[model samples]
Target: MTADPVVETLDALELVDHHCHGAVTADLDRPGFESLITEGAAWPGVSPFDSPVGLAVRRHCAPVLDLPRHAPADVYLARRAELGWAEVNRRFLTAAGTGVFCVDTGYAPDRVTTPSELAGAAGAAAYEVVRLESVAEAVAAGGVEADAYAEAFRTAAWEAVRRPGVVGVKSVAAYRTGFDLDPARPRAEEVTDAARRWLARGGRLDDPVLVRHLLWTAVDLGRPLQLHTGFGDSDIRMHRADPTHLTDWLHLTAGTVPVLLLHCWPYQRQAAYLAAVFERVYLDVGLTLHHVGPARAGAVLAEALEITPFRKLLHSSDAYGVAEFHHLGALAFRHGLAGLLRERLDADELALEDALRIARWTGRENALRVYGLPDGSPDDG
Candidate 1:
């Protein structure tokens, strides 16, 4: 008798990492950074296990602002070069088996224009570039420069979406950098105005807008919007990570823009709740797989699957830097998901098809639809 087509199918599918940060380094020393690249390229199961896709967010912009006051711009620029477009793609693609990479326009003035350059450098045949824009940053820099920035960002987004390998924009609204919403220090009007302006600038309908703006702009642009809904750095209060905060926004955007909740940190159950309740609310299991350890990751994925439709769930490595953290984080994510599926299904003697769906469909299919990419096997399609 033929064996059940479970593990084979699971292993056959490609992995679409919905969120990762490339072209950013945590280390200042050149040797240390190079070591990171070496380590990242050597992550296990990265090359042979499955097809790897990456959505590279620009990590240099805001994160740089948080660096120690003494750090010089030259140092920052040098670090960025070490984490340059060529090096990042080479390392990640070589190690992780990455086929498509969506590059973002980072926050820094110098690096803000890096996405397009990277796309050009990668030669569209190899990787996909997606430019990203931050609403809060534009608003904070309000003036002609803001307008110029908006125009530049809009141009990049449109170019990326239209380019051969480039994907659509990945709009980031809320972050620990205080770019999104902060109840204690709300920038609602600023955010709202900035979002409206961004939309008017011909931004794609699928990109996310932070906080209530996701709903506010849904009526005009009926597309998928990503939200940073889970665990983040220590600066962000865990309580604020609740997906419940976006409940009203989800309802408001009902039947309009789809919501892809990013992270969903310690509150995975709550993320599952939203996904279960709203067809438009999808979950991208990015940070949990990397930031959380094995045991916690297992529990969270189990809870999410139990409550939410597997179709609404997605995967992301959330890779940043060339360090061990980035490599291990991506590896742990895939491993954690595989392990969790094994633990859950082994008990019931269930087939691996469900796990495969979670791995492939949940991650890539939903993202493809949201980003408006052609739906086919990553290899053939």
Candidate 2:
């Protein structure tokens, strides 16, 4: 009963998955649905979301197909139970040589209810849950609600950070599809007004309005903040997906508060640039790893590593279903790393120290630092 060497090596490294959306909802099951359809359909061996080739065919033929969405709390509990997060943590403790950091994500409306429940369920002493909330109310209040939301965020963030296992705040500012673009839309003006009010209240541009407020709040209270970056869902215009779009926020912050950029998709170059330019702008190369597989991921990672400081790079699965997909993502990430090492770095020249550093630093250390955890290795309880 020997373990696969690759699996064993990955296990021994104890990698930290910095960015992942562990919320359980049918919405997160989009990939699973695609897999099921592809598995059962006439066109066998065809992945609906397959890379460049499949993407081309899909663009030309099936462009804009609707996918299933999952419900929130129930989906989260179901997936966690199915994935055996508790068991996963135990196994992680056994395998992780250094340690692994798992940051649980919760959007605003959802966070108002889920965090307490999830904390009870996970039961691990050091698990972190980052909360997400809408800027809608804040926007309507004409900066009043925005200021209140900031205070609310601060209260929630500090509570979570101080909780037995909770670590930091995960806040999002923009909606790729939900918000109204025109003044005609109800409350649209409110949202925009709130943004203006928050800005007038000293909010910076490069920072997501909600996140900028949260970052300032978090930093003042001594907590870490994770912000969404790069391309989001299919509904979002690709142009808006660019992390470069946040240049104003970046310039405004100037590394004052540590920010973890989630995804960093097609805009890896821009992400890399931010990572290089701002000491606090850390990039999580996870969602892209899930959307684009190993080969492309290898190229992206190689390019990012070559240009960006290794300390700012983070690894994550960003997988939400049964732990199966999460494990798959981790394996895929390792394979991508191996490929990058062999193709870009000289063979046998990839030192274990560097590998360990990438695996540990990107995975957990940065997260631990951002979240302001006790200055010691993570302990699995």
Candidate 3:
């Protein structure tokens, strides 16, 4: 088969991973690595290696560690161990061909690389996307009074977004309260009552009223707002996590700031619908592509772009804990998107120039424009 120019172009284009967490700085044993790859519990009777994402790591990332493609899980792990975490992270992160990383710096159970450290490993530039829930939780943990919670949280969140290198804000409301909550901004009394109850109970910020406040606050911050939608870990109720549930909320916030829907998996079509209709709404199948692997990436990407404007689609890895995801996510995206555009090009559905333009927009340009990041020269990683 002849090589597709679309594939070649995308393979060389450096992606801008719009939403991802930092890679772990510590060396991971098989168990530690396995836990990070799968969303479900790593049951004793089963191994994550049998899953699509695990197999993807071996097939796509093994060679980055100097092992052959489709290397056995144990062999792959051994090779990764031999390389050490720093070297392993460098190899995969560089090999991904990602020029920029907008890393989410919250949710660190293990010691992970900072944005600068992660960017350094990949020879890329990095920016920060503050998590709204983390900011609110910190205000609570800092001992703010119930009556004063609303003002205190607003001030803290504003300060967080104003920090140097902070380009945007994110909310894991899907994981916490889900998107089915009342769309309107919570009233002041309602916020105080919710904060008082939350401060007393004290844990993750899951109160619906408080979550609504976080979402509204993200809009008021005036930077790009990223929302976790569709599939997630075991804690999420998938039905409530759908992006369409935010229709009312999106309507209310139109023209305020860019609303980025991240990791829309089974709901990619639904996300596509919103991106098509809403001027400021954008969507990326970031976590979904890596989980589905390169073999099925084109199919998922196809659904996401079915009605989505080419400019509204962006790339992401949602990679966390392990460095293998950084490489695998880019590989899947390059292969998946290349294949889709190649088919269209062969059918005369689009011009070669147009296909190339879409390739650039989706892989890198779209993210840079959306986040207001400089289009720096591509890193030759």
TM-score of each: 0.62, 0.62, 0.97
> What tens digits encode model 1's per-residue C-alpha lDDT throughout 73-147?
355446456565455444434344333334433433222224344333333222343324443334334433433
List, residue by residue over 32-80, the lDDT tens digit for candidate 3: 9999999996898899999999889888888888889899999998888
lDDT of 2 by residue, 36-67 (tens): 22212324555554544233223221211111
Off by over 4 Å in 3: 1-3, 376-381
lDDT of 1: 0.49
Task: Report how far off residue 258 is in candidate 2 (Å).
Answer: 1.1
How accurate locally, in lDDT, is each candidate?
0.49, 0.50, 0.91
**Positional deviation of residue 108's Cα in model 3 after best superposition, in angstroms:** 0.6
Count backbone overlaps in model 3.
0
TM-score, cand. 3? 0.97
